[model samples]
Target chain A: MITPGAALSKSAPLLACIGLLCAWQVASLALQTESFPTALEAIRAVPSILGDKESLVNIGASIRRMAIGLSLAVLFAIPLGLLMGRIKGVASFFNPLLMIIYPVPKAALMPIIMLWMGVGDMSKTLVIFLGVSLPIIYHSFQGGKAVEEKMLWSGAAMGLSAPQRMLRIVLPAALPEILTGCRTGLVLALITMVTSEMIARQSGAGNILFNALDMAQYDTVFAMIIIIGAMGILFDAAFEKLRGWLVRWSKPQHDMPLSFS
Target chain B: MKVVSLRSDVQAEPAALPGVAPAMAMIHIDHVSQRFQTSGRQSHLALSDINLTIEDGAFVSILGPSGCGKSTLLYIVGGFVQPSDGAAKVKGKVITGPGPDRGPVFQEFALFPWKNVLGNVMYGLRQQGVKKTDAEAKSRKLLEMVGLKGYENFYPKELSGGMKQRVAIARTLAYNPAVLLMDEPFGALDAHTRTRLQNDLLTIWERDRKTVLFVTHSVEEAVFLSDKVVVMTRSPGSIKVVVDIDLPRPRKRAELLLDPRYQKYVVDIEKLIDDTGEDEIHA
Candidate 1:
């Protein structure tokens, strides 16, 4: 159904991305340096990277750590944030603690976390959890707090109990903000995961890249970097799609543009 | 100044038909007063010693100037606000909090943005333990009653102000509340739409008579929609007069415009507001 003009506009971003890749390839060729692999060299290195069993192990481990850490953080943070936002007593107790902890650079806690838990998956996961949970909690709190007063009154007048109103009205109204929080938290989780991996015993993509760079395996380093970048793009796209599906009801009110990342 | 007695003229005729018993009082506001703390060490009273009785099946409007506590009075009756003194009783039982037995329609058209017309209407029914299928059926019927038959699937944001208010009315009625408390339900609409909704509200009210306590700033709207209009003074509002509209049933806007009795009632209510000399009441 798309006309030529419509198709051109739809494909414009993809075409621009292709153009940028071609320019990178040309620059790599002109430089003729071993450290900076050309796009072709990096793409060719993918087979050997896949052939190496350690690559799969590292990718699997990283994915598992991300899943575990992010899951635990979301499970605890969302409810705590909602409670703090909706209940005066809960907010009074948690507000000071949240304010103090939220601004502290979470990445700076990695050493302390490692000292407490040792250089194990627990430390890495804790680091990721710490980095990710604060943003989600803060955003969810704001989301829950910002539900319109008249909306609450309507819920009350409809004879809904407090719990029912919280579940059916407040939570749904806060979904868009919570989803935004989750998106931001996902990026933080990945960053903390890589940092923890690089600092700890070598298993994830972060360790693989460092190992390749130390050994002067320029092609492998470039390949690992490209793979991590692709993973980040993929996760961002997936979350954006999830957001669209979850919050289609609020599309009219949410004026924010759809972001690529 | 002494509060004028406008009800005397209508009550003198004793207009109840022969075979019908007198209507029972549904909502009783007994010496209610509300005070709000504006800032540190200062408080403003909204309603002062307000007393009124809404008979069962009667459509009554509380007409006043803006910030005159008419809405506060409605909120107290609906159990959303507690009076600093006295209380509001529904069917002789003191209201402690909001319940399914009384529904409120707000001027802001408080339809849930996430819920479409059908879902919004079914919300109260669902809360009251009705099954999903039954709630849907009841919601469909109510939407039809409010002239939103085809818009059941449309979200509140997609609807015009009038249509949204229609959906809000349908949502409130779906729960089958014994009394409907409306606070300027048509206040946000255009003049044309407001007139149309007033007529539609009358039609709907006639079919199923629930005791209604409507609050508004419009003199004409109050006269057009109610069996009685209670006028209140500005700031720390108290009832100035209760004017009875004894116009015949099934009244049309055009026909009522020409009726001398309707004109007399409108002017009398307007004069009540004018006598206060604060602000002119809107149409």
Candidate 2:
């Protein structure tokens, strides 16, 4: 049923991606600098870099940390946000504290965290957790607070108890917004994990990049960068798939090219 | 256009209707007044001394100008709002809060966006602890009654305005409430859809004869679908007139349009609202 134009539109993103890689390859070859590796060189380097056990261990460690940190942040922040959003007493008690701490740069807190917890996995994971939790809490709070008044009245009229209303009506209504928050938290968790790894010289993807740069393994560095970028894209795509499956009732917008019957 | 005085005879004994059984008050609103605090000190009175009685199995429409507290009065009867003075009672019991006994269909068609059509219709029954098999059977029947037989799997967002309201009506009826309170259920629909729904509603009303208190601004709609139309004054609303619509049952829109009696009823209610000197907005 899809038209030619629809097929073309779907391939547009892939075309743009190929175009960007071609431009990067051209620029890198023209410059011929040791610091910059051509796209071909970086692509050639990926197989060797991945095959190496040290680099593989680093990549695995980074992903594992990000997963744990992100999972914990989502688990803790969602409940806290829902409670604060639904109950006036909880909101009043926590609002001032959240406002004050939410904006302080997580990177700036690393030194203090290191001083308290020492330069280890504990401090790095804690930094990532702190960075990720703030946005999740804020967005989930907005989502929980935004349940329509009319919907609440309708639920009440249907003889639903307050708890039943919250579970069946309010929670589902807020889910899309909460998922958006989780996606944002995922990106933040990845960034904070790398930054913490680099600062602490820990065993992770960032540590591999630092070591390769020190040894002048330019191709290896570029290959690691591409791997990290691919991971980010993969995580985002996974979240989008989850959103599509869970919030199936919220239809996606139809902006595709016109198709004849 | 002609004006008739049906108000004088009907106001004397509110329950005295021909062909209906000995009267039993299903909903009794006695001097119900609602005042809302606008700001720190200012208060806006919505309804004032609105006393009315809706007999069991009667279809009554409350007609008024927009923002004249017609919805507030309906909400009070539905127990969604508490009156500042007096009380609204259903079957001799004071209504403190919303219950399944008085089902309400809102103007926005407040359907759950997450649930599909069948799920929304089954929601009340599920909450009331009905078995899944029975609830599904009853819900499917109600959906069929509302002309939404094959649309059971569709979400509220996928439905048209008329369809969404149809789902809301089906959902309300599935719960089997004693008194149905609809606040301008067809207000957002187009004229064609509105008339079709009006006819459909009348058909449904004729079958079950559940007591209905419908609120709307359309004088023609009130005359066509209601047994009695209670017109209210502007702002701090009170009962202005009650026009008893004695039009024969199973009325047809095309035939009723040419009927002189139907025309007179519409004209009378229109004149009563016009006499209030309020500019016509959305009712």
Candidate 3:
């Protein structure tokens, strides 16, 4: 059973969110600008935004793109990471390439991708893929490389074959690091998904936000910002739950004792 | 000139005789020496001119002060390290690398943390391609033998220090190695746990009769577990004495503690160890 404090902690973020919304409402009212909608106006627009089929369709499209790109990134990253991790020569050969390419903004490649793929869904998907793949690959590689020598020796001494050792011992030991990488990659994928839509596509959450901004629908723009924030939080929560399940064995046994005054 | 040459050849014959019948030696440490070379420094000698024989099915303990290469010698026997000068052989076969034939129990109870107690015991058998049903049956039997029957499904983290060592021993013995190398396997346990494990180890060794080469700093432990305790001198270590343990089998802990002979062996070894003053040299 989860502790009472943990349950309370989960909702603390929502409370802070509400407090921010109230503060924004007060400030917007004081400013009295049409460009900055009050919190009440944004809240009133939420139902309309939910009722709008186009906005829902755009959200769906963005999620679909993210799912496809992230799936492809994981598929490619796992094997590449394992290879680079297991073989020193391969790691050395690819190290410079990854280091050179990983840091350059994936958005910077959108124009080139557009030129190649004609500004279609393909180009946006490619941008998200590029942004997500590197971190995943790098983290998995580091994780696999970090397997302790003694653990490997233990496997070897037990007469485990190379393949068995890698699969049973090395992979599980490296899993925590891989999950961390996945978490980071997932956040990057979300950011890049929005950026790709804003720059290249015309049918996603980014497009809706852009349209709302153009029409000076400040309340709708505020609604879009809230949706984006919710999406980020939702994805993070899901990834964390999966990670916790996968690495339950890796956690330390002792929990800190409660102190009462 | 012919008479003088004949006399010299006859005198040199004894030296060559030792090399001719090397196979008869169960474990041959043939002038073996190990050196470690670090960057920008002279090579350090860990072991030097160490020559000894361990008879078949003999229980031997290598007792020495810290940095005396006691553990290094055990590693060499286990085929985990190579000798810089000569060679170590088991039953006339040269020690090249680690194999299932030689099982080693580490001090840290290096059972894989992910596996349950039974799984860890069965690991060696599984690796050797034993069928699951048979391996499981065998593992269960071994676990029962180690007094860990009910706790088979528990992971290493859940077990006590003594229990973990039992699992480690069971894992090593699952391979049915001809020789067992234990490097201070009870060093980390509490006094009570250490004594309990020592007794358990003796029980297991009595039943199996496998050649055991145990390394430890404790003189009493060396005397208690060994058929012969080979006392070693410190730094660039060499065998100083081999004291025979004449105590009978199925010896209880209390009896050994009270026995005058056991006490003498412990005191003698401790005195010899203290006389070396080699601990300061290593420091």
- Highest DockQ among the candidates is held by which one? 2
DockQ of each: 0.61, 0.64, 0.44
* Residues B148-258, model 2: lDDT tens digits: 999999999999999999999998898889999999999999999998999999999999899999999988899999989999997788899887888887889899999
CA shift at B161, candidate 1, in angstroms? 2.0
Candidate 3, residues A1-261, lDDT tens digits: the string is 989999887777677778998899899999999989998888788778779998898889999999889989988886688668988998999899999997799999999889998777798888888899998899889988988755666677777667877888777778887877788888889999999988875889988888889899989998888888778878887877787777765745243132010
Better of 1 and 3 by TM-score: 1
Q: Give the CAPRI rating of model 2.
A: medium
A206, model 2: CA deviation in Å? Answer: 2.0
Candidate 3: clashing pairs of residues: none
Weakest 10 consecutive residues of candidate 3 chain A by summed lDDT: A252-261
Residue B26 of candidate 1: its Cα lDDT?
85
Identify the candidate with maximal lDDT.
2
Which runs in model 2 stand beyond 4 Å of their true positions?
A1-8, A83-93, A253-261, B1-12, B281-283
Structure candidate 1, residue pairs in collision: none
Q: Which regions of candidate 3 are displaced past 4 Å?
A: A1-11, A43-54, A76-95, A253-261, B1-26, B280-283
Full candidate order by TM-score, most accurate first: 1, 2, 3
lDDT string, candidate 3, B1-283, tens digits: 0011111111111112121243234666777788989678888888987777777677889988888898999888877777787777888778877778778888887777778888888888988989999999999999999899999989888888899899999998997888888989998899888888889889988877788899988888888998778888866788887777878777798888999998998888788777887563210
Q: Which residue pairs show collisions in model 2? A: none
